[model samples]
Target chain A: MSDAALRSPLHAEHVALGATLVPFAGWEMPVRYTGDIAEHTAVRTAAGLFDLSHMGEISVRGDGAAAFLDHALVGRMSAVGLWGAKYTMMCTPEGGVIDDLIVYRRDWDHFIIVANAANKDTVIAELGARLAGFDAALEDVSAEIALIAVQGPRAEEIVARMCVRGDDDIHAMRYYTAANILLTGDIHAFAARTGYTGEDGFELFVAADQAAAVWELALAEGAGDGLVPCGLSARDSLRLEAGMPLYGQELTRDTTPFDAGLGRIVAFGTAANPRGAFVGRDALLRAKAAGPARVLVGLVGDGRRAARTGYAVTDDAGTQVGTVTSGAPSPTLGRPIAMAYVPPALSAPGTVVGIDVRGRREDMTVVALPFYSRAS
Target chain B: MATVPEELAYSAEHEWVSGDTDAGVVVTVGITEHAAEALGDIVYVEAPRVGDTVVAGEVCGELESTKAVSELYSPVSGVVTAVNEALERAPEAINADAYGDGWIFKVELSESATDLLDAEAYAASVA
Candidate 1:
């Protein structure tokens, strides 16, 4: 395919900034602007802006929207109020995860779901097929909506300055909530207080044609705070340090939500359960009761040698136990960290293991999730 | 991208080979600017220890960036005489100054391994 086929709205801006562009999820996204460590440190200490338009957004509207989503997703749909967002998953009947997504209640009868870019088509098809019997309308709005994520310590202040209506009081917005703001005459944009960097941030959804203008505004307003344009390389490092799971890496069609250590998102017997008959409920309940055979755990390596994806996890005696799902030399921690799945017996914190990186063995220690958490 | 140093000979695999025949045919090896650009950012580097024997086209080290890990192949056969100790503390120097203080290892060539590319040839190969 031609390179023009996958260019995003900010392609020219990225090139002008001397970004290293790479193919990611069918889109030509910047892997790093200037350098990875610089961008990573910028997000940790100051602020960073990201062009996230490649993410898929699908909307479900109608009277049965809530019921349909409750039956289709793993999280409790009824508990979320209008303008509330919940991180949830769509799983297969055998309890394997199809995709982990965020569901936003746009209104009483409208819901918007955002999914990974690579899995957009599959997610839409599956949702449509499942909701065919229900009274709801499903539409794919990925091509029409553009997203920009402003993240870091000063993200809210920067956004407040760019927005015409709201003051810095928007900074008071709690996490996982979204509000609509009128940036100009009759031009409304939705801003969600959510992020993957484990920092205070907002994701703004705007019309496709207005994306570049909004990005320019955010950059101008945030320049004084040391806001730089971040790319996929820094994005990976930041999220890895925050212990957030990437869809294909940490969750996949063959991996169950329970096995991925996301049982808290599943509401089976709660009062807010709109799940009359959701997919994977039975198998998930059984797995929850009996406990998953394997669980995902965080690992910290002894040195700078990173244990990459697909590296084998083994005991000191060389018995193969699990495989690494995602690993990197964390820019923030200045050491190698990873996430992997091991047998239940070896999933506890402080379990000593070795990662077979190529032909060499690197010592590692199993640790709790969220290697770094934002101070409350 | 950083400038390719004119004094150094380069290999098709993007490694720089610099040395003098007067100094017992000793050559210092490091990755090129183009290689560092493609790798994005340097995170970890595992160099062969001093006195370890290496053959041409053999893996002598490993370089890990934020995106992926790649094996560093030796351009000539030799025994490792010196290894970069600074990489253990600050590997990003490879991304910053690939040709100078970021040199990875030094080797005393067994017989002056031939067929190594020059800077122009190496640049053409990458282009």
Candidate 2:
């Protein structure tokens, strides 16, 4: 890590835990505490706490908040229920993705949008330019806030114990719903049943100064349940196993949601009930109608060698078909898995393909989207 | 704080060579504990062919970890005598016991190389 790199609020805690720090998106963040595989297994079996403070948080408020967001994002913001969170994306007019974000509706006219750390400035600038005459106010609250997550099978029991509020119960909180929680010593925080890992979890949004306190408190409360402090490396592998698309990897400015096999995220207008009034509506509709030329697919390799990002995906004839976006040896599955973008004709399950790993065309079979999912 | 065996000859690329430097020299090669720790979990080890010849400081194979792939470089010029076939099914043995059971291969030296560093020198170089 460089001297001038941005540090997380829990930087001290990570250093105390002997974490290996690395530079990610201009921020010096913990990549692992003990090791990547160990932390990943902890999340899958027990629980793991993650410091996601580097993510961006932007607030939108005013009477036109919902309307403004409807025009700003691809998902229908007007349909977001109170205290409901929705996964959506901001796109260019040409249907190219700008960033995928999650919006939490605090009230009818107030909402908070959490975005990726690397694209924080891009999202702020693009939204600022598009809010010329909008009645909503956009405030970047990234620096003032910190995001922490407790994820696993024991997540609910652990996070439910952290909320000191007698009136609010975390057990009653539905998935993707947010609530205000009062912790010990009157530390107020916003808790949501949301996480990147494909497990039951809760994300706590707290003040920057109170982040370390909350982190220690959560870890202590969940210690007996096997909650370990994880880092970005484990988080990446866990999300990849869940079949989630990363911002710069699976998504980019040149690709539309349809190209990533996420066309359902886009709200195209219908004659009977028109709701497509946002950017990229036309281009996305055209892409949807014509069907995406290429689609994202999951690939399972025959051996232990993982096909990492930027590896070339070739057909049986050895012709270049697409490129790998993300991949790793799944700690749970005991096999190498990856996600790549290939033509729709070759995206179906059982399609034979080859991944060019280290100049060798390793055999890979196209599988389903998610390689692992916790039983509900 | 990785374990660095004092009796081993170390290469700048983090491989440790162990054997008697006799008239007809043969040495067993494996990645150091420090290198294994830095590489995260070892998932695969690509070994050189038994009859293949490798030169010092040349890439002969690769070690695939959970995080990324690292090149395996030869510490001295030699012809491969044997490869660790056990690693094909259980690569995690490198993470658990990188020095003993995780030995990657053995090479019969054509001309003994004298540029390899001792344990202390290798530790200092890494530090």
Instruction: Report fnat in order of the candidates.
Output: 0.64, 0.68
Error at A114, model 1, angstroms: 0.4
- TM per prediction: 0.96, 0.96
Mind giving the per-residue lDDT tens digits that candidate 1 earns over A48-113? 999999999999999989888888888878679989999999999988888889988889899999
Give the number of the best model, judged by lDDT.
Answer: 2
lDDT of 1 at A71: 88
TM-score of 1: 0.96
Which pairs clash (backbone N, Cα, C closer than 3 Å) in model 2? none
Model 2 regions more than 4 Å off? A166-168, B19-23
True-vs-predicted CA distance for residue A323, candidate 1, Å: 0.8
Question: What value does the lDDT take at residue A5 in candidate 2?
Answer: 89
Model 2 per-residue lDDT tens digits across residues B1-127: 7888899999999999997643359999999998998898888889899999998899999998778889999987889999999999888888889899999999999887788889899999877
Estimate every model's Cα lDDT from 0 to 1: 0.87, 0.90
lDDT of 1: 0.87
